[model samples]
Target: MIDKLSWMAIYPEAALLIMACVIALLDLSTTSPRRTATYVLTLLTLAVIAVLTGFNAAAGKTIYGFGGMVVSDPMGNWLKCFATLALMVTLVYGRPYAADRGMLRGGEMFTMSMLALLGMFVMMSGSNFLVLYLGLELLTLSSYALVALRRDNALASEAAMKYFVLGAMASGFLLYGLSMMYGATGSLDINEVFKAIASRQVNHQVLVFGLVFIVAGLAFKVGAAPFHMWVPDVYQGAPTAITLLIGAAPELAAFAIIIRLLVEGLLPLAIDWQQMLTLLAIASLLVGNLAAIAQTNLKRMLAYSTIAQMGFMLLGLVAGVVNGNTYNAQFAYSAAMFYIVTYVLTTLASFGIILLLAREGFESEEITDLAGLNQRSPLYAGVMAIAMFSLAGVPPLVGFYAKFAVLQALIASGQAMHIALAVFAVVMSLIGAFYYLRVVKVMYFDAPLTATTVAAPPDVRAVLTVNGALILILGILPGSLMTLCAQAIVATLAS
Candidate 1:
């Protein structure tokens, strides 16, 4: 039987699971096309979960439960809080789009997204290999269903099929690697594995081999280069609302799992994984930046941009634990955390504008589709401009500071190789800026294709405005969030 502490550690997750089921059942009784009642309930549930997690994070206590199969820590709780809020914003922005495209027929989208978020929470809290894999499967399965929500759309169906095939392959790789790790260390609990590896008795070759597969699997999850083949196709083919659902909050879960697997569980082998991460980062920057430039489709462009942004985040991971000292580990990992959080904020606004501009029977997908958006609606155009500028790493935007923090961490390592990687990242960012700015130019300079003006529901407008403003506000005052990340990392490390 589970103890009280185990239940406490998972209260928010329990609430989410129960509420999701309730919403699903309640939705069946409603006949409204938009499922307005179900939608409001879902948002309310998410808001409460976000607040609950935020309080738990602020408590700054690390608790392990269920025979140490799971953990609740400041870092995990904070990420969960942010992810919950991000999902709330996503649903708000996505509802109109989903309604227009008839993707909300039975409230599956709402239920599935909540289930997906529950999966993320589990992934973040999991302390055992089996537990993490279980969470990963739950999240991926829900995502596949949500992607295929538009069953009448052939493209959505195709995207779902591709995602399932590729996702299953990646999951297999991760599971096999975890099995190898367990074989080598004789434990599935992360702390036990860490102790076993730190003892240094495991066969080096087998461990390294498992690490290779594990890194490859993680690279795919984060959409890094060489493993990013599915990103562009899925982003372009899925209904835009579904695209945002897949793109936004899932990233935090990915980051949390990486920390759990690599930094927390396998740090004794940092030299090996750090080298692998470096190669992945370099390739991601090169491929993501160059390929994004050639994409005229806006969603595909952002997909590549996500690849490049993740590459930059990986640099921070690469800088951690240099020479096995681990003196710089907290700072480096916190920098990555900050970058990802800010990147998600910027992404929500960018896609919000895209969803807003997409009317019934029209997809604002191509770069040319945004032509003279400023003439049609300056509010949206300005929001889009801020997102683009931030993504381009323009000064006084959060993206710039995110990049700077990562580069600073790299430089602080005082290694010639780390400095050189920082330089390469900088150059890639320069190339990335061109594509990002091209979007801005199209919005401000080109002629409007249609005379219709953009209009948004008040909720979307308010959230989008706040989202865009956060990108700028965080840029101007990044210290608080950066400090919060640092504290969370430090607390996690201490526990």
Candidate 2:
């Protein structure tokens, strides 16, 4: 058991879970008396755990435990780091948004966020269907609570109810698929399932049925089109802070599950699944991008954009060329990983500013909310512009490099139709840019609605300022990061 525990590697998750429970217990004794303490503890635990986990693991290695239920590998480690950092940023961004609205201490949102993060950690490292299900449930339950953090906001409550019910249905589909796979292969382990697929002749009926449910469930989590009805409403209704966390962290975590299940467990069925992903990629690309043009609410626009962004990510996976004939496979996967990192940074900057700009009783979801931001605050306006441009895939930004890599990979793979689709993605990208740029135009070109300036906390400003700058810096120096992404993905796939 002790030996198994070593492989289980229960340090980071265990520590985070303990910290969350302890903080919740303290909150039971004193309500909102020391939310700052909770925030500080959560940050410290995450930072310490990130460092310790990196130090403990050998890079490019997979450490397995629980009889192959969970395996912490390079992809999981990197994404865990990404998720932890994104969560911390979300906490800081939430501080002013919550404080100004009298909702900072609302139902221990911070504690619930940490718990969701613990679930994400598990999902990122999961190797078996059972472990993935458990982790996803933990994440979902906590997210529901966070969305409903403000008891008085009927909108928040309604959003939470919708999210909860839909999330349950998605989980049911995932579980059904898992059951079918287990029945077919007599294995819950992803690797063992792969082995079964390799040895046994294809069972078209069972395989097709299980594959659809599994991909559908993952698509639901990633906010891919056709399963994306929940995204816009949820983003528009939830507290801005909760919306930020949901936007940045959850989809990336979902990507982890997709990599595990699809690349590992279902690779043999690529002929069957790739077509499905291509259809989804096109649907999401068209719907998410085209629909954003109609949305005046900034968050909802971004929500639809999120679905579109997932389509771009799916494009890379769809172009999964083997490592033969010149490393294109290696390039595509790396580009996808890099795309996630870029999305995290860009989205954080955008949301961080939204938090800073929001007035009391206002969530800053409207483009006009940013009118004459340049006159009000040049620094804020500049940062927001960078985020907007980066999101739009404009040149000299991280977003461009991420998209370029994926496009190159698809084109290289002889998938000309998909390449044409990606080109359409580029055009729709320009269409989507109109909404993002609308905010910028309001900020830089128009007049301010008020004379007094909105105040941003030092910590929040510091983080946003840096992240905003980092996107451009990365855009300039993308080679090293691109190398890291390429190497990490290839190594992960090869492993």
Candidate 3:
């Protein structure tokens, strides 16, 4: 029998699973263009779960449950809370677009998203390899189905097949890596693996071999270059709503798993992995930025940009520990965490605008499709502009500060290579800016492609406004969030 303490640690997850089931059942009996009742219920459930996760974070005490399979700490709880908010915002922004594409004919979009959130929650809280893998599969499986939801679209079907094949291969890599570690350490528990490695009881060669596969698997999940072949195709092929769904929220989960596996479970092997991460960061930055400049499609451009942004995040990870010293670990990891959170925020708005511009028969997917958007709707134009500028890492926006923090963390390491890496990342950011600014120019300067006069629902308008404002607000006042991130990392590391 599970004890009360263990039950409390997973209450939010339990609630989400039950509510997802309830919403799926309820949707079967309703028939509306937006799936109004199901939409409302899903949003409400996410909000309630976000509150619960916030409260859990506030409690500030780490709780291990299910015989140490899951551990709820401030870091995980905070990630979970923000992930729920991201998902909720995704649904709100996606509903109209999904409806326009005939995807709202059923409630699978909302239900699968909720299930994906549950998977993220599990990933955030999981302290064992099996639990983490289970969570990942749950999320990926739902994502595959969501991508194919529009069965009539040949591109959607193709995207689903590509995602499924690539995702399965990545899973195999991760599982094989885990099996190697288990064989070497004689344990499946992450903490025990950490202990075994730290005590120098494990085979270093085997561990290094496994680390390569694990990093490859993780790099695939995050769309890091060399493993990023599927990203542009999938992003352009899937429905925009599904694209946004895939793009925004899973990143938070990806960040969580990186922390859990690399920091918590494999810190003793920092030297080996950090070098790998550095290579990944450089390759991602070079490939992603350069490839993005050649893309005519907005979704594909953003996909390459995702790879580059994740590269910046990896820079933070690489700077965490040096020479077997973890003194700078908190700042480094926290900077990565902040970058990913703010990146997701900007991505939500970026894709939200794309979805808004889409209609029953037109998908505003091409960069030219955004021409003269300013003339049609300044509010949306401004939102997209803010998103574009933020993504480009321009000053007085959250993305700038996120890059600043990571660069600071890199330079603070006082290593010549890290400093050089920081400079390279900056140059890549400059190159990336050209493409982002082009989108803004098209929106403001180019002639209108049509005179449809883009009109968005009030709720979408409100969310976009808030989303744009938050980018500026967080940039101007990043201290509080930075402090929160630092504290979360410190608390969890200490525990």
Leading candidate by lDDT: 1
Q: Which segments of candidate 1 are over 4 A away from where they belong? A: none
TM-score of 3: 0.99
Q: Using Cα atoms with residue i matched to residue i, what is each candidate's TM-score against the true structure? A: 0.99, 0.95, 0.99
The Cα error of candidate 1 at residue 194, in Å, is 0.1
Give the Å error, residue 237, model 2.
0.4
Q: Rate the local accuracy (lDDT) of all candidates.
A: 0.94, 0.83, 0.94
112-183, model 3: which lDDT tens digit per residue?
999999999999999999999999999999999999999999999999999999999999999999889999
Range of the 10 consecutive residues with the lowest summed lDDT in candidate 2: 321-330
How far off is residue 471 in model 3, in Å? Answer: 0.6
TM-score of 1: 0.99
Please identify which of the two predictions, 2 or 3, would achieve the higher TM-score against the true structure: 3
Candidate 1 C-alpha lDDT tens digits along 1-495: 999999989898999999999999999998999999999999999999999999999999999999999999999999999999999999999999999998878989999999999999999999999999988999999999999999999999999999999999999889989999999999999999999999999998999999999999989889998999989999998999889989999999999999999988999999999999999999999999999999999999999999999999999999998787999999899999999999999999999999999999999999999999999999999999999999999989999999999999999999999999999999999999999999999999999999998989999999999998899999999999999999999998887
- Structural RMSD, model 3: 0.7
- Clash pairs, model 2 backbone: none
